[model samples]
Target chain A: MVKKILSVAICAIVLLFVYAPILLLVVYSFDSSKIINIHEFSFSFELYKQLFRDQKIMQILFNTVWLAFAAAGLSTILGTAGAIGIFYSRKRVAKPLNAVSQIPVINAEIVTAISLALLFSMVALYRTYFSLIVGHMVLCTPFVVLSVLPKLKQMDSNTYEAALDLGASPAQALFKVVIPQIFSGILAGFMLSVTLSLDDYIITAFTKPKTFDTISTYVYNAVKNGTNSSTPALRALSALIFVVMIVILLVINLRARKPANKGA
Target chain B: MQRFHFSRKQLCIPYGLFLALFVVIPMLLILFYAFTKETDGNLSFSFSNFIGFFTSRAKLSTLLMSITIAIISTALCLLIAYPIAYILARSSFRKKNVLLMIFILPMWINFVLRITALRELLDLIGLLESQNYLNTLIGMVYDFLPFMILPLYTTLEKIDKSYLEAAADLGGNKFTVFTKVTFPLSMPGVISGITMVFMPSMTNYVVSDTLSNFNITILGKLIDEYFTTYDNWHMGSMISIILLLIIFLTMLATGGFKDNEKEARGTNLW
Candidate 1:
């Protein structure tokens, strides 16, 4: 009993450590005063109102979401195809191919960003939308393959063969028989790609054009100058993200618990 | 000869092309740029960037500082995450995923926003400006805790209960069971967790950048300075290669990319 109690105490404290900053941000979002003085503690929607009223920040929001979806879509297709190919390949070939695909996942983001920048400047394509999207795609594709490969492993190895024996072409077998079984993995990979692309800063910063700005680059710039960063609007935005995360995680858990549902 | 053909090899075309063009060539480009330099109005491949980085006292010290910070933050994250993951995995409660979500919920927020909020929290406690290194450590631990916990929890949860039953059946005490069985079995998770947290903390300049008010210059920021402020790709690429070598050495020591461990990591991840 004492052991269990100790475990509970430790878990609670660590949770506090994780959530304290976010909770503080949520509170400050409602504060009327700036400059981190909460002694006055006048509660208002001042920061949230400011966040919505700012035209540039709102535009940054749209740009960030739009970029994430576009990048995620392309990477998902590339990654899904890659996973399927590797899953179907000969053992000797697949083993090395699988290992090679993972180099990006393990490399430092700075290294990846710099290498992409170097290669783009060779073709004079640096700081373009194409470079930005490709950079995000590079960051995300490996993980998508990783996610999808396990589901393929869990599936029966003969499903495709059976489909082909039924007079279906290879393309038909992939699109009709195999894809449905692994659709959940594809969806999961897409979600993961969206998150990674959204959270990315280093890659985006390196490859983005001068006129483009995401929330991360914007927030980093607004704060990196000094200790007196006046961008409290991020506080409200942070709280909003926290709420969305809870909803998504809960919905995922609930769906996972039910064996019947696939969320497609 | 005129007819089109399709084969399983065709599926390899897109990713194979992607790997060659995007990943392989770009990595080779970094190596080229790292070794090449402009001297007397000519671009020539030499070891000056390597020599220059090693000869400078400031650059070596920053590398040491970055390594020290990464080690400390990685160690702190492991210490805090292990028990929480252990509890969450071993809990009999049905709604433990909700509890897990509480620990993971903070990660979904933009990390820069979270760090900015951390600055406010540190300021409220009067530690932001006065103790720059401590705040940086605090911010890193906060930012990276989830990465550590998820792997540990997943590995711990996947351990067969029968192993514990067998250990107990053999008259092993709780202490013996943990040290002899539990900890040994969890090594894969621990190694992966360390790999995930250590390398990034070494170069994730934003953590220290947000936490310290220009009082610190870690290796990542040094690379950024070379690439941006000085327009010195040779120097920047050299530093990046050095960083890559450090990562490669550390992973070699920990068996991070071994085939067996790669299989262990690439499956069952949420």
Candidate 2:
């Protein structure tokens, strides 16, 4: 009983450490107190209003969502194809291919970003959305493949054989037998890709078009210049984001549970 | 083609082409530019760019400072993360998954947002009042902590529970069990997490640029300054090439990449 209590305490403490700053951000988003010291506080929607009212923030938001979706979709497709190709191949080839695919995941992002910048400049694709997309795609595809490959590993080879023996064509066998089994993995991979693309700042900073600005880059400039005094507005934006993350994580957990319960 | 079979040889083209274009070719270009110079008459390959970087006192100081910061931050992150990862892996608590979720959640948010949030938080605490290198180091650790924790958590989770139990049963105390059994067992995770955090922290430009206000000149910012402001492509590529070589040398010196390969193989088992 003591051990269990200690475990709970440990878990709770870590969770607090993780979420306290975020909670503080959320609470302070509504705090009437401009300064950090808040002996007395009043709830207000001023920050939220200002966040919406700011035209530049809105543009950055649009750019962020646009880049996230674009990078996520392209990388997901490429990574899905790569993972499936490796899954379908013999073991010896797949092993080396898997390792090679993972090099980007482990390489220093700065190095990768700089390398991409050089490559784009050489190819005369620098400062274009195409360069940004390709850079993000190269960075994110390996993660998607890594996430999805485990699901493929769990799949029985005989299932495809059975489908084939039942007169299913190769295409039918893949679309019908393999993909259905790996749908969850595909979804997880997509989420991972989107998150990585959305979170990416360094690469985007290097390769992004002059006119385009990601949310990260936008916020970065604000913090760098220190002219922006609208702290509450940024806090409000982070608060909303924190809520969105909670919702997404809850959904993932709920989905993860369903499978295990069904299996049991 | 005789037939469209998914053979090992066939798989080589896409992966090979992508790696060559993205990794190999650019690295070659950087190296070429690193050793080249603009002659009075025409461009020529020379060693002046490389020579200049090593000889420049300010640039050399910046590179050393960046290396020192990376080493410090990597050490601090590992120290803090190991204990937290230990609890997560060893504990039989309710809501373990939820706790793990919280630990990993920061990673999902935009890196820019997280760094910005920390900057605000530090400002609130008045840590940003003075341009403290310690504050900058803290920011690096905070930003890269998840990279350390996640790999460590995964590795620790895979450790056989029996090893710890056996250690305890053999009259080893908690610290002994941790050092002799747990630490050795989780070395692969430690290696990967360290490499994951260390490499980025070493090469990262934005964290220092934002948090430290360029008071600290890391290699990444040096590369950026040359490439962006000066339009000195030769110098920029030289710095980048030197950065990559240092990374390669560090990887060899620490045996970081070899352990990562082992970790990769072990992780691939399931």
Candidate 3:
């Protein structure tokens, strides 16, 4: 009983450590004061209203979301196809290809960002949205390959062969038989790519044009400039993100529980 | 079946071309820019950029400071995460996945936002922009602790219970069983955890930037300044190459490359 209590206590403390800053962000979102003062506790929704009213913040939000979507979508398709190709190719060809794919995953983000920045400048494509998209795609695609490859390995190769033997065309066999088996991996990869792209700052900061600012670069600039850095609207944005995260967790939990309930 | 018009080899072309264009070529570009100097509209091979980096006391100190802070933060993360991971792995908790989700949910939020919020809280506690190493370490561990815990949890969870039982059956106590049977098996996770935490912590400037309010200069920040503020691409590329070398050495020291062959599916973040 004591051991169980100890374990629970440790878990509680760790979780508290993880959530404290988020909780603080949520709490401060409602503070009416311009600056964060622990002593001042004025409750208001004006910050959230202001967040919605701010055009620049809205633009940043749109850029971040659309960029994430584009990067994730493109990387998923490319990475999933790459994984399949690696799996089917001969060992000699596949080994080096697989190793090359992992370069982005293992390399430091700063290194990748700088290298891409250098490449863009050398090719005279610097500070373009195309550069930004390609940079993010480079950052995200490897993980997609990594995620999908495992699923491909676990899948039975004969399923596709059987589909071909049963009068299905090769393209049809690939689309219908092979893809469905690896769909979960693809979905996971897409989600991971979206999350990584959404969270990315180093690469985005390097490759984005001067006028283009994602939420990350925007927040970074706000903090760096120290002018209106502590705007309640920013806090509101944090609170909004925290709430969205909570909603995502709850939805994931509900979805996870449903299958178990059906099983039971 | 044998003579289908489409070949699997053809599928490799797009990604292979992408790898060459983006991955292979960019790295070559960094190397090219790092070693070549532009003089009178002509480029010549030179080591002046690299030599300048080593000769500058301030830059060398920044590099050392970054390494020091990374080491400290990685150590702190390990210390805090190991026990929690052990508890989670060994516990009979039915909702472990849910608990894991709770831990990882914060990571889903934008990292900069998390750091911003953390800076605010630290400001409240009189720690923000104090130029305190402890403050920076706290921010680093907070940002990175999940990376440490996830690997440790995965590895610890995979240990066979029968080994513990057998150790106990041989009169080994809890500590002995853990030391003899559990710790050695979890080394891979520890190594990966170190890699995950150390590499990012060393390379990450945002955590220190936010927490220190741009007062602290690490190697990453130096590289950023050289690239963005100073327009010294040659120096920036040289520092990046050095950083890459450090990463390569760290991976080698940790046997990360060797383990890749055995666990080719890749590192698990989920």
Task: Give per-model TM-scores.
Answer: 0.94, 0.87, 0.94
Tens digits of per-residue lDDT for model 1, A191-253 = 878878888899999999989999889878877765234667777777777667667766766
- Candidate 2 vs candidate 3: which has greater DockQ? 3
A125 Cα displacement, candidate 3 (Å): 0.7
Cα lDDT tens digits for candidate 3, A195-248: 889999999999999899998998888888896465669999988987996787
Which candidate should be chosen as best, given TM-score against the real structure?
3
Better of 1 and 2 by lDDT: 1
* Model 2, TM vs. native: 0.87
**Model 2 agreement with the true structure over B110-153: per-residue lDDT tens digits:** 66766766666777777776866977787788778777777787
In model 1, which residue pairs have backbone atoms overlapping below 3 Å? none
DockQ of 1: 0.53
- lDDT comparing candidate 3 with the true structure: 0.84
DockQ of 3: 0.54
Candidate order by decreasing lDDT: 3, 1, 2
Residue B53 error, candidate 1, Å: 1.0
Candidate 2 runs further than 4 Å off: A1-17, A32-41, A89-100, A230-232, A258-264, B1-19, B253-255, B258-270
Clash pairs, candidate 2, are: none
For each of the candidates, the C-alpha root-mean-square deviation to the true structure, in angstroms, is 2.6, 4.0, 3.1
Give per-candidate clash totals.
Answer: 0, 0, 0
